[model samples]
Target: MENHEDVDIVIVGAGLAGLTTALALHRLGLRSLVLESSESLRTTGFALTIWTNAWRALDAVGIGDSLRLKSTQMKGFKIASPDTGLFTSEQALDKDGKFKGYESRCVRRKDLLEALVDELPPSTVRYSSKVANIEELDRFKLVHLADGSILKAKVLIGCDGVKSVVAKWLGLGAPVRVGRSAIRGLVEFPNGSGLDPMFHVNFGGGVRFGFVPVDEKSVYWFFTFTPSQVPSYEEDWKENPMKMKQFILSRINKMPQHAQDVVEKTSLSSISIAPLKFRLPWNILFGNIVKDNVTVAGDALHPMTPDIGQGGCSSLEDSVVLGRCLGEAFLNKSNEEDDEFERIKKGLEKYGKERRWRSFSLISVAYCVGFIQESKGILMTYFRKAWFSSYTPSAFLKMANYDCGNLVS
Candidate 1:
């Protein structure tokens, strides 16, 4: 008993990218189907930092105001180190940089996903739908789902994430592991966290840990470090939050007591840990990110380390750009399969070209930043103590200053 469907467009993975893509298309009077392998909406990551660029994208898709209402805007940041007793002065975020009115917020992943989902029409997302295999045809692509269902799509967009199946189908290759792991959590102070709306960071003991207030009562924090050896109980730790909590506390003892307090206060179920991975800039520059009527976005297209806090922000940008490109093609399409194919191919080509360099730059910057901040050596120490202390803030803020343009444009 196989169910069959013929869709104008099929988007895999109902993540920030996929849902935003669908919403952008919906805004342009277009329709798309989003297939999620999970039984329901998945909000795995506790939260993410959305910068000025991401807010612009969110505004384009009509969810910016709602998200802004739920989160607090970050004002500035302070960097310090416990090992070397190096403390950098707090710096205010530049408001008149490349993009004026600098803004950033640590938004709950659930809120961001729900905001996008709310804008989309009901039944637009089909859950429990996993893409098993794909086959390219003369005019359409056949998408095989694990549940004995087949989707014939005129265009296919994959937002399936780091271990993307569609990326593999597009010959984009696998993401490279960065020899580091990150543990992130969101903890609430029922009364109040009494923390200012700013970014707080500490780098030492082969680790880089940071925290920011998502709101007055909730704070999001992350600790990243290179693993010396595989923990035999890694799987057990993931399942048991207490184990994860103990593990993080043990490694980040040098962090501020308040920072340590946040971790201690975090509920068992609010923590998660995973190894970081990224696609090489060279691979993205030369890979087949876009092929004919098929393409990828978000982590699927350019999975990068979380050092720059642009992984989610960049994914939001991807959705808006891809949506605009595809919308332009569909709006002017003729009523013929061959013409439609050419139009889609051209639109995707436009998307791939637009994102290739941007993706490469982001991956490279995130990798380099992580390396410089986390590596331990006399030369690296000097660079961090001197160069990074003065120039890091400006450099980090500059990356968040991109504008991906509006959907209507």
Candidate 2:
């Protein structure tokens, strides 16, 4: 055990949460080691909808303007139930709009990850380093890797996704599957997609689809539907990208022609699918998210349905908040190592406390929205229509308008 390596802070899973956490710490004059299981950065998600809240976090970390140049600003969004031919649209902002800070964009996941990677110090992320198990080392954490090596850290933050190993170690409950799955793909148009900058969404017949232009030449799209909706839906679709794309196209046959074309034009390599899962809000509210100096952030802390599109945005917020808390603890620490550990522990506890309610609120709202959107029963249909009818633009944008504060405190 004495031969093991040591670090001041260790972040697991180099996805959005992990990278942002490392960058946030770096911005505060702190160094952190990030361990990624992948051979390189994992940027598999074709793209993500970065709302204004995420933009605030990015700006805090000093990468917002650079990322902003890579994507187009969304004008607003439109919702339609093609089954009933009902449509509604709302503006998100204007030249002098009231919602000045509430902007949105569809950023390529690869570009976002690379932007964070560029700002980080060289060799900050160790690729292909998979954690096999974790053990308590008195005042620190001992992380065992599959390659038969041990690394210890004073503080450990889990940014791993929904099935996070660190979350499981902290005794957090598993995420619950909502009996639905979504498929996403990136489509390119040499002549440009000719679509409005506004986000377009359609839902009906137990299928939901949405598309937004990532840029002039590329469009990002997603389709979510109950697994049972397809009479011949096979497990093979999960492993076969071509099978998955065809199945998605089949379900959205009744959607607008442009929507259908987007799916048809998507290359097989750009498509990915997964089952939707969420940790119960109550579980997060009462779970052991923080144990000593070890805690989880992002999806590891609150894996909710993507109905509200905060999955990535909230993770960015977590990095900013967690960095601020830990930065404060470390900067004001005493010389005693034990005192340092204690301060770090208290910082994690503060992070958990601050994020618990916010995580719960987000999970609850996203779950309810997905439930209403996906429900197909006659009674639920009535309820869904009623809810959407009264759903104001302000209410829809309320969650995205939150500010997670700065990393510098």
Shift in Å, residue 209, candidate 1 = 0.2
Q: How high is the lDDT of residue 153 in model 2?
A: 90
Tens-place lDDT per residue, model 2, 352-392, is: 99999999998999877777777777877776566663363
- Superpose all Cα atoms of candidate 2 onto the true structure and report the RMSD in Å to 1 decimal: 2.2
The best candidate in terms of lDDT: 1
Off by over 4 Å in 1: 1-3, 84-87, 94-100, 229-243, 333-338
Worst 10 residues of 2 by lDDT: 82-91
lDDT (Cα atoms) of all candidates against the true structure: 0.87, 0.86
lDDT for residue 13 in candidate 2, whole number 0-100? 92
Write out the backbone clash pairs for model 1: none
lDDT of 1 by residue, 38-140 (tens): 9999988999999989999999988999999999999887777646333456877654344348889999999999988888899899999999999876678
Candidate 1 root-mean-square deviation in Å: 2.4
The list of candidate 2 runs beyond 4 A from truth reads 84-88, 95-98, 236-243, 334-338, 386-395
